[model samples]
Target: MSTLDALQAALAEEHATLWTYGVLGARTSQSASPALYDAVTAAYRRHRARRDQLRLLVRDAGGEPVAAAVAYELDGALVRPPQVQRAAVGLEAAGVETLLALVARSSGEVRDWALTEATWSAVWQLELGGAAQTWPGAPELD
Candidate 1:
């Protein structure tokens, strides 16, 4: 795939992740679930920043960035803190896949940026209670 294509795919995943995080954040209570709320909020902010950066990257590459869907379907119920954490982990895991693709299709600064993003996703997954993986984005290795 072309770098632009990979970037767009990554952008799309970011969009979905941001949407899911937003929902997760809304369901969480600051006083009742401080840790989960903070985690979700942090992930949401990170993804939002990445989404904006991706838009700039796409535009600089002379391609239009893909728009986020009106809403994203949650992986499962997010009523409780554990459920929210699980969902956040799932989203980061999925995002790692796209970031890996971005790294593969890009080079130089873009590839470096993608590598950083993928590493952060893996760490974020662990923060959300996921097991650490030798190859975070490659589920086949897990």
Candidate 2:
């Protein structure tokens, strides 16, 4: 896909991710545990920053950014803290894969910046769980 088109797709993934995090955060209960709750909150904040960046970038590209829905269709019924982290980890893994695909077509600064984002965010994710591959598209074309 074209860089702008790729960016739009990435933005859409971010929209879903942002929405998922919101529900996941709110759903975290007293039983969800403090550690998982804190981690989930931090994850959402990071994702939100990236999501907003893409939103503005969409404006630069003369396209409207996708609106994040109030909620996403989650895979299963809500569970406890450990399960919440598992869900959060899965979401980030999927998002990393999508972002990796989007960044594949970009070059120079955009490519480097995209890789940096993916790498760092993946690192954040790994902090909560284990190491997971973010970039199936690497060694990136750009």
Q: Pick the candidate with the highest TM-score.
A: 1
How far residue 59's Cα lies from its native spot in candidate 2, in Å, is 1.7
> Local error of candidate 1 at 85, Å?
0.6
lDDT tens digits, residues 1-142, model 2? 8878878888888888888888789888646377778888888998889888888877777887777666679878666666677788777767767677767877766677677777766776777775555343342532
> Can you write out model 1's per-residue Cα lDDT over 3-98, one digit (the tens) per residue?
999999999999888888889999999999998888899999999999998988888778999998998777768899888888889899999989
Error of 1 at 98 (Å): 0.6
TM for every model, in the order presented, reads: 0.96, 0.83
Worst 10 residues of 1 by lDDT: 68-77
RMSD of each: 0.9, 3.5
Which residue segments of model 2 deviate by more than 4 Å? Answer: 30-32, 131-142
Task: Give the clashing residue pairs of candidate 1, or none.
Answer: none
Residue 5 in model 1: lDDT:
93
CA-lDDT, candidates in order: 0.89, 0.75
Candidate 1 accuracy as TM-score:
0.96
